[model samples]
Target: MDIIDENFSQDFHCLVYDNAPTHLKRTPTAPSAKKMTKNTPPVGKNWLVEVNMYDENGKQIYNSDGSYKKQHVQMSSSGFTEDGTPQSFYFEPGHEREGVFKGMAIILEERGFKGCVGRNGRLAECGDFSQGCVTAGQPDCCCRRMLYNEPDFVNVWPRLEEVANARGFAVLFLPKFHCELNFIEQCWGYAKRVYRTFPLTKKEDEMEKNIITALDSVPLETMRRCDVLDSRFRSL
Candidate 1:
């Protein structure tokens, strides 16, 4: 991103990435109901989400021993209510337990969901979330499931997209398991085939030269054809 901004400041670019887990990971502090408690926490105890600590310049802080430093922080906002009012996951400043995490029940109640709290309290999530209530056509079967289905929660962008969008670059993730849709994969294959044709060499410098030569040997016409094929697959 720094190189792009420095060399081509005026050009708009949209980067495409594979749907890998590393690329789709959200920031640790992003809102999530996966581990939220069903009711308010015990007195003097809080349920803050653990997140990596960052320094003044926004870089993650590392401990002297090399692991990342961590701290408990409130989760991000739980989106808005039906009337357009913003919802928060923690009690407001004036409350007695201010800054403490609001468990799933109260959070759902604030979003106008009734029956979230009962004599027995609600379940944090369904028994088998993916194949349970959702598959049974009961989206509101549990507090956590309902929150998970909320538009704001469902639409939260991954960190990569957030950073790219902030810098005026659009980011798109290619569909998972579809290498044919990635034109660069074809170019890499072509380079590898050319690389095998080179004479065997033991010298490091000679090996590097051979690798670069093999890559450069790929024809521009082949790249164009691969791109066209990728576009056709995408259109389908």
Candidate 2:
């Protein structure tokens, strides 16, 4: 009846990476959409979910020379694969990430909690208003379903605690602003580097497939390179 009863230490449960779109070609010089609507990301249903993404205006994807989009993506989250598995989490993003973030109240109704949030909590890759933001301007998308859109963790974190309480979990949030410590950051970097190795068409679908293939090319190698586990990198 435990989500993850692993001991807390340098390594707790499996590393859960945040999710984000890689190398999205957004630009300012490109002809702008009069009013581009935000694509609604799906809502997750799993007990735990980590996301990496931002609501960058699709039109703002170019620079003067078009070399790079100046947007400062945190580059600290993972994305989904073809089969829907996250870079980690050993579960599907739809069921786990959006589901938990929005369904925490429902989940907690079944489980009981045990620890202060943001302290002694389970492992999770945290995202901010970066890619997961759902402002009043956006429509009803499950990814941003933070239960009431309270606009602050204080207003929303308690519901998560309730879910943990229901499930007898101790929500141990990573340290404030401690993305580097989470192994998932390494995974995002891994996926990006792997995707770049290919022709890597800038289109989302093609590039995402390239990434997933790269991820599948060598699971053990990727895991080692990302340091998902404690082991030396094996040579091919």
Candidate 3:
């Protein structure tokens, strides 16, 4: 499948942007207790988690106003059952998608993605712990599900300069979780519908031919319509 279009080079800039938008089902993991208890105090239900303020030299950190700085707190968590049973487990805050993205950011930086800037105008840097730090301590209930101010790409950002200088490509990351923005997705739907019309027991070569024909059969006008719709939604 070669698409040789002179216009591709004539009009298009040598830039590319993509993201591996992974998703996970958010199953209800709400802790059992609803009210404040010994384990479920005002801050949160997570028993092992606590805020311990400290300075760069490991000394207790305090603000100029004689108050502890929440940003410099030592956060720790332990793995235990919902019933408060003791378990031998260390906290893994960067598990699952967060973990993968953090590693990807580090790898991209090492591979010449250093010094890149994001679309949001933030310099490519590792996660900023201070950005999400609380200004003051509170009980678990008051602090439960608190939103932190932080960049969305803090976990998976590669530097922009290194991408252009080292890789000679520009990147444009799309908004997260918006499939309507990608016209190819709509084209794929049309192709899939066409593919389903073929006989199920087709031979291997015939299947390949059918698949290719189905993909090519997508109307250009339909593709344009998808783009228009996407633009309309973005305007909203």
Per lDDT, the best of the predicted structures is 1
Which 10-residue span in candidate 2 carries the lowest summed lDDT? Answer: 31-40
Q: Report lDDT per candidate.
A: 0.86, 0.37, 0.42
lDDT of 3: 0.42
Task: Using TM-score as the measure, name the better of candidate 1 and candidate 2.
Answer: 1
lDDT: the better of candidates 1 and 3: 1
Candidate 1, run of 10 with poorest lDDT = 128-137
Candidate 1 residue runs with Cα over 4 Å from true position:
128-130, 134-137, 219-225
lDDT of 1 by residue, 1-236 (tens): 89999999999987778899999999777888888898889898999888888889999999999999999988888597657788788888899989888788988888888888865665777776867575547888888889888887788889999999999999878899999898899999999999898888999999999899989988999998998898788878
Which residue pairs collide, candidate 1? Answer: none
Q: 127-163 in candidate 2: lDDT tens per residue? A: 3334553343432222223322322211223334445
Q: Compared with the true structure, what per-residue lDDT tens digits does model 3 show for residues 46-150?
A: 333234466789798777999766531112112233344432222236643221112222222232333222333222222332333233332111211111111
Counting clashing residue pairs in each candidate, in order, gives 0, 36, 12
**Model 3 ranges with Cα > 4 A deviation:** 1-6, 9-18, 21-131, 135-171
How much does candidate 1 score in TM-score? 0.88
Instruction: Estimate the lDDT of model 1.
Output: 0.86
For every candidate, C-alpha RMSD to the true structure in Å: 2.3, 21.0, 20.3
